[model samples]
Target: MDVVIKDRGNIKWTAIMLPEHVAAVKQEIINLEKVNQPLLDEDRLSEIEMLIYEAMEYNLQLEFKLFKKGYIESIIGSTHFIDYIKKEFRIKDKNELTHKIPFQKIVDVQKV
Candidate 1:
C-alpha cells in the first residue's frame, strides 16, 4: 500500500478527486470569495466614474485610492487624456510620465 501524506497548505491530492467533487470545491471557493469582496455597487462605480470625468474636464489634479492586485495604492495626478475605448485614464504625474490607471481599479477619488 502506498502511504500518501497530504499537506493542508497544498491541494496536490485534489488531482485525484472525483470530477463532481472538484467542481463543488471550485464553486465553494468562488462563493467564499464573494463574502470577503469589497462592496462596490453600480452607483458607487458610477460615482467614481463621474468624479474622474469632472477632473478630466477641468484638467484638475486629483488623488485616488485604488486596488491593484488586492493591495491599495495611492496616486495623484492630473488627467492628461482619457482613452474611452480602453476605459483607462492617461495621467500626467508629478514626474511628467504618463500613467495608465484602469477605470475598474479605482476605489475612491478626491480633488488634490
Candidate 2:
C-alpha cells in the first residue's frame, strides 16, 4: 500500500492498494468499528468516518490501477466486484472468513 497524503492540515488523505488489499483493509476497518462501537464519542465517530473514507479511496485507486493494468475485463461497480469474487472463488458460505464490507459512500477519486 502506498498512500499520498493530500492535505495534512485538513485531514484529507489518499491511498493506493491492490484490489485484494483493498478488500482486506475494508474488512479490517469494519471490524475495528465493531470493536470500538462502545467508545463512539464525537471524535471517535469522526475518526471512524475518516478511516472509512480512506479505505474507499484506496479501493477506487485499486480499481483504476487494475483498469490501467488491463487485469479487469471491464469497468464495473464495486458491488459487482464483490459478487464476481464470490462467484469465481466459489464462496458459498458467508462467515467470519468472508469480511462483509458495508456499502461504500460515493467517493470522487478523480478529484482527489
Q: Number of the top candidate by TM-score?
A: 1
Instruction: For candidate 2, give the lDDT.
Output: 0.34
RMSD to true structure for each model, in Å = 8.0, 19.7
Q: Which residue pairs in model 1 clash with each other?
A: none
- Candidate 2 residues lying further than 4 Å off, grouped into runs, are 1-37, 60-97, 101-112
lDDT of 1 at 14: 80
- Model 1, runs deviating above 4 Å: 1-37
| Cα deviation of 45, candidate 1, in Å | 2.1
Worst 10 residues of 2 by lDDT: 61-70
lDDT of each: 0.79, 0.34
Local error of candidate 1 at residue 66 (angstroms): 2.0
Question: In model 2, how many backbone clashes occur?
Answer: 0
On a 0 to 1 TM-score scale, where does candidate 1 land against the true structure? Answer: 0.59
Can you write out model 2's per-residue Cα lDDT over 21-110, one digit (the tens) per residue?
Answer: 767867777666442112235664465445435545554222211111212222222222233343321111123132233222212112
